[model samples]
Target: MKVELYDTTLRDGAQSEYISFTVKDKLRIAKKLDELGIHYIEGGFPGSNPKDAEFFSRVKEIEFDNSKIVAFGSTRHAKVKAEDDMNLRSLVDSGTDYVTIFGKSWDMHVRDALKILPEENLSMITDSIEYLREHGIKVFFDAEHFFDGYINNKEYAMKTLRAAEEAKASCLILCDTNGGALPFNILEVLNEVKGKIKTALGIHAHNDSDAGVANSVIAVRAGATQVHGTINGYGERCGNANLCSVIPNIKLKLHINCISDNQLKKLTEVSKLVAELANMSHLHNMPYVGRSAFAHKGGVHIDAVLKNPLTYEHIKPELVGNERRFLISDLSGKSNILAKAKELGLKLGKGSPEVKVILDQLKEMEKQGYQFEGAEASFELLLMRTLGLVKKFFVLDGFRIIVDTHYEELTSEGTIKVRVGNRYEHTAAEGNGPVNALDNALRKALEKFYPSLRDVYLTDYKVRVLDTTEGTGAKVRVLIESTDGKDSWSTVGVSENIIEASLKALIDSIEYKLHRTRGQ
Candidate 1:
């Protein structure tokens, strides 16, 4: 079966906390979505904000081959004509051939929100859809709060959909705006509506009940032709249905055609790109595209997957542009080490002395609170050292940090000394914190020897207490993620002193970059 994918990332997704996209960001994202084979891209509500209005005006310059640009808005006001409604007028002026207008379906919303009679609400829906159709725009009517409306007053909800159908709406999208409806409820309501409405059916689901994807799938099974959602499930509150999960489920599990298999391979990249652009940390546990989605840690699961990946993985990770990871942990076995070695292009046979040695070292380091799962760079460095393939780029001589408080103002300063090749360098710098000061001083000293170090910078730093029972002096583990704009890597360190831990991780980060660059 053919199903249409409608993405509202620019519209509903912008309502998420801390998700503010510039006009350039929106246009870039829309193009990316189009490249991924989405059928429709809801640019934004053009009348709601100046940025969205400007986005609609600027989006016309780019050519989208597969996806159609859609302007989103609400129906005409009950008190005014459709032509006079500013929101409705903006949709027409957006210059898009497609428009989505949501209308109240529940009688309670009509009386309380719109402050109009139920009949007037029906008239508004019909008039707005017909007016947009008259302007040579294909109309998709979103029945907002549809599940709740159907439960409260089935007759009025049916009437609202009938009004849209009578106005020649291309699709009637049933929206679960509150996102509290269950899959069974969605199936039941959509089945009843499918029998009543002659127009094409669509679904717009939210994740408030954590069943948005399930509900959307059920609606599709119940004959919804178009599925509306956002990439990475980004939206207000819990979020909208996650297209990353929904699209694959509909195509692979349901045996339906959504996008080509080649397009599916770009899923992970697209998901991460959206999260990066949104300035949010990607969820490691997210279903298909997460970093840890196919990670194997336990010995039993690792051995089984090594023998045959189908024993543990539901689908091949490569199908979604992700790779299976054999995480090095205390629970890992020799098979885990072999798999990781194979991935790093190391030749470690079964029952090799090096395998046991590496396993023992990993267990000891993990006991010391080194988490190799999140610090793959550290793990790779450790593997290279064990295989005698690593060379030290520099040696740390010593470091000192000093904090001074004068009158209520506080300042942190760091000094470092290091030997690069046959020469020695010393540097000092101040920063907002002890770690930052150390980072600045160390980078300042290293840049003299390695010019490429100027392009490298720390992107993220996290510290975790290994043993709280040891009180304030407990061992702390530091993980630092660094990037050189083109690529990124993670390194880890552990020590009783927080500053020492940070310094170790920082040193590893710089050494990793140098090693990769120099082909060491």
Candidate 2:
């Protein structure tokens, strides 16, 4: 069966904490989702907020090749006619051919939330769908709290769906509003609802209990024609079912084609792109697209995967545009180094003496609280040194940094002295912090010798305390990520002094850039 994929990232997903989409963000994300072959993009509830209304008005200007835009709103108020309800009027005015509206499914909600009788709630749903259809809009009815409502009042829940069906709703979506329904219950209720209602069924699940994806898949197995979710499982409270997981599961595991196989390969890129736009850190352990999803760390697992990926992997990572990774740590073996070296374009044959030396060095460094897995630049430098390929770009003579606290504000100044071949340069600079000051001073010193250094800048800096037990004397590891417009690299350093650690990482960042630019 060909299942439809409806994305509510711009609507329900924005309800997630710390996630807000601007008009341009919504338009860009909609185009991205459309490129990923989403069937429908729920722009937002047009009448709920001015931003969403503006989004709908502006989204009409862009041409989406794949996905259809959906305007979301609630059912007409019990006290007003559907045609007179401003919410319904806004949905029509949004100029989207598809409209989705949620209505009260639980009898408790009808009485307490809407303050209306059960029949009147049913009338509200039917009237809203009828009104939208009369305006030549295809309506998808969201039976909010359908599972909970079914458990509380099966007859009323079924009647609500029947009302939507009688009003000729294009699709009937069962929403797990509380996100507490188990997969079994969802399957059972959906099976029953399938027999009761004639409209096409869809699943909209939340992740309060962490069963959102499971419930969504189970519903599809039972009988659902569409699945509604967010790109990264972003939503209120917990989250929505992650479409990143759901779409692949439907396509590969269930043998149902939700999106083309080529589009499936763009899953990882799309997932990260969405996270970047939302200004949220990507969850490394998220299924299918996460950084750690296909990573192998244990010696046994890494060996098995190296021999035959099927030995340790359930699915090929490349299928989802994610690559298998051999993580180097205390648990790493010779094979791991060989694979990593090969990946880095180094010609280190299996069982080479260089590999054993690098392995020994790595183990000793890891014992001293150095992590190479996250510091690829540091590892590469280590490999180059072991192979006798390292060339010093400059020699640091000395440096001094001063921190001043006056007028209730803290400022720092750094002075650096360096030698480039026979020429020496000394410079001083001030910055917001000691690291920034050091960076500024060092770059000023080297800019004359290596003008391309101006094109290189530190993009991110992270510090981790290796041993908190040491308290104030704990060894800190600094990881500096630098980008030279075209590429990015990460270098690591560890020392009891934070300044020394940051300087080591900074020096490595510069050397790596110089080495890539000039073979020497």
Candidate 3:
């Protein structure tokens, strides 16, 4: 049987700390999930809140090409009939064809958390499933904490599943609620329950002990037919099993085509997009879709890769919407430099004198905490400047900035003795901040010579305390990312003064833009 993949990114993912998706974010993420071709999407608990109810109501308008939106909730309360449970009524009213409900599978959870007898808990599970089925909604019963529950009370856990079977649940999902169960435990429990139940089983894992993916793999091998996860592993605590990791592992490694080939091609894009929507920086070391997933830094590795790509790379980066990067770092050797030079349309023979000079500059800058791996524009500008290809567009004049408690002021700012092709222009401008003032002043000074600078604008400014309580009283590192309506680039600067760092990065951004424009 074909194993199915169900995504719960928007619902369970919101359970992740510091993550709250706006309606716009939810819609965008839902569209991407649809594009990913997941078999099911557990949106949210409709009866739990107004936002989820609104999401389900609006989600009906979104036509998914490959996935079905599922409504997730819990079973009826103790002493309450399933037909009369408020939670069950909400599920039916959500208008979703599929409804997933979790019950007390563990004896401890039943006796302690729910404070009810195991028999009563089993009845609640059975009655809830049958009620949903009676209302024409397919029921997916989550045996929460299944592995641990099975280990503690095997007979009770299996009996609870039997209850689900009697009620005719469409699928019984085995959940690692605490997210601490290891694969061996999963395989053991799955081994016992694989053929014992008449219903198709599913695996819903979390990543507390970092075994979510491993447990998922083990369960699938043991005959589970469905995998539950969130994109980029977004969920409570350490997060859920990353569908980005699970899909490729199952599809490419296990020869199980869990998602369509077309969806597979857009996997990396969708993964990054979801990360963007979540406002979380994509983990560079994350397996297939990360920025550093296919990066090569060592010299020997680059040489071998250039000789034969398979020498260093296990699979083509393009297979997952990722690209290989030749990083320039201390470990980078001659092969790396030559490859980078070749990419920049520059010729560098093995052990060239110019290569030594450039390497010396790079090493010295790195010692000062410059990271060229993420600042390719700065690196390229440094290379060109060292090669005597850079032209000085203008010179900076004296400028003064003053700041007080409530108000700040910048004055006596204008270019003087500035040479631009045997002509000079003096100008001044005020802005919101000193760095902005400096930027405005510099642009005003150079606008006549480089009129294209008029179109440039700063979009992002990031500051880092490099040593975090060390290095010149927390040496400030600044990265300013800019765009000229057509292209974007980033530049970095580090200094003891935060303003100075910001100024330097701003200058680099402008100069880099100017150089590229001039060259073009």
Candidate 4:
């Protein structure tokens, strides 16, 4: 059977410690989820905050192609009737056809948190569903702490589900609310109550026990037709089961068609987009959509992948909009060098002397604290220089920087002279700091000959102290990442003097930018 995908990103994802999506963010994310072919999106509770209320109001302008919006709320209070409860009334006001209502299934919560009898909690469940059904809303019932309740009191838990099923809930979602249940526990409980109720079952898992994805996939194996989760697993208390992982496991591993082939190819792009909107860095090692997911580094593994990717990869990365990557490192062999050389448009054989020379230089530089794993531009430049294929755009004559401070304010100036094709150019510029001044002065001297440098700008600059024991005079490694609008590259430099290290990386970046202007 084709399983249903229910995403609670806007609702549960906002509960993550560092995640706070604005109304605009919710709309954009909801739109992305729709385009990616999700079936349901749980928008936040409108009654809880003005932001969510505004989101529901603004989202009406958007016409989704694939997803239906869902509003979330709890069961009616024990003392208040369903029609009189404000939270239930708000669910209807949210202007959604589908709604999810969570009710206490564990007797412990009923006796302690709700301070009510078990029968009263069941009535709350029935009343909430019945009220929403009467209002033309499709209700999805979340049995909060269902697994825990089943373990402590199987008969009571089963009774709660039967109440919702009889009350006409569209789907019964079993929630691992505390997020401590294991796969074995889920399977054990599910086996005991497989056909006790006629309602269709859904699984809502959490990651505190690190089995959310596993439990979700297993629930499908046990005959569930729907899975509830959030994108990137963002939620409270270790987050929910990651739909990024769960969807692929269902469609690719379990031989189920939960999502379309075209939708599967957009997974990586959507994952990165969501991370960007969340103001969080895309996790490098996240399954299916991470930068390091298909990266091969070891010598044997690199050779094997070049020959047959199936030896190291579970599936072709293109299936999920990701690509295979070969990492350059000390552990790399001739295969790695040859692969990188080919990627840079150079042809080299396994026994080529240039390969050994480049490998030796790479290892020596790594030992000197110059890392090329993230600095591929520097590695490419090294290959060109070693092969006598490098072009000298300009020859640096000399440069100097001066800094002075008055009160809390500071001023820095850099002067540089260069010979571009034997023509001399000298320039001076002031900046907020030494590095900035140097960059400004260098471009001032060279932009006349290489105007493409005008488009090149530093996007990221990082410095790592390689020898902390030396303290003030410790050697530092500087990595500078530059972009020319169309492409970006990283270069590295190592020196005890921070300014010198920065200058070295800056020069390499400029050279790379000039090379990019060429069709080569």
Candidate 2 steric clashes: 0
TM-score of each: 0.97, 0.97, 0.91, 0.95
Which residue pairs overlap in candidate 2's backbone?
Answer: none
Deviation of model 4 at 119, angstroms: 1.9
Tens digit of per-residue lDDT, candidate 2, span 55-168: 999989898889999999999987899889999999999999999999989999999998888999999999999999999999999999999999999999999999999999
The digit string of per-residue lDDT tens for model 4 on 149-239 reads 9999988999999999999999999999989999988887777667787778899999999999999998888878889998888999899
**Cand. 3 Cα-lDDT:** 0.85
Error of 3 at 131 (Å): 1.4
The best candidate by lDDT is 1
- Listed per candidate, the RMSD to the true structure in angstroms reads 1.6, 1.4, 3.0, 1.9
Report the lDDT tens digits of candidate 3 across residue range 1-520.
5989999998999899989988678878888888888899988998888988898889999998988889999999989988889999999999999999998789999988989888999999989999999989898999998888999989999999999989999999999999999999899889889879889999999999999988898888889999999999999999999998898888887888888777887889999898888888889998888889989998899999888889988888887788887888877777888888888899889868888888888889888877777777787888888888878765544455554345454343322234576776666566676677667777777777777888888878778887876866888778888888999888989888887777678777878987888822
- lDDT computed for candidate 2: 0.92
Instruction: Write out the backbone clash pairs for model 3.
Output: none
Model 4 poorest ten-residue lDDT run: 511-520
Residue 173's lDDT in candidate 1 = 98
How far off is residue 226 in model 4, in Å? 1.2
Ranking by TM-score: 2, 1, 4, 3
Q: How accurate is candidate 1 locally (lDDT)?
A: 0.93
Which parts of model 2 have CA positions greater than 4 angstroms off? 406-408
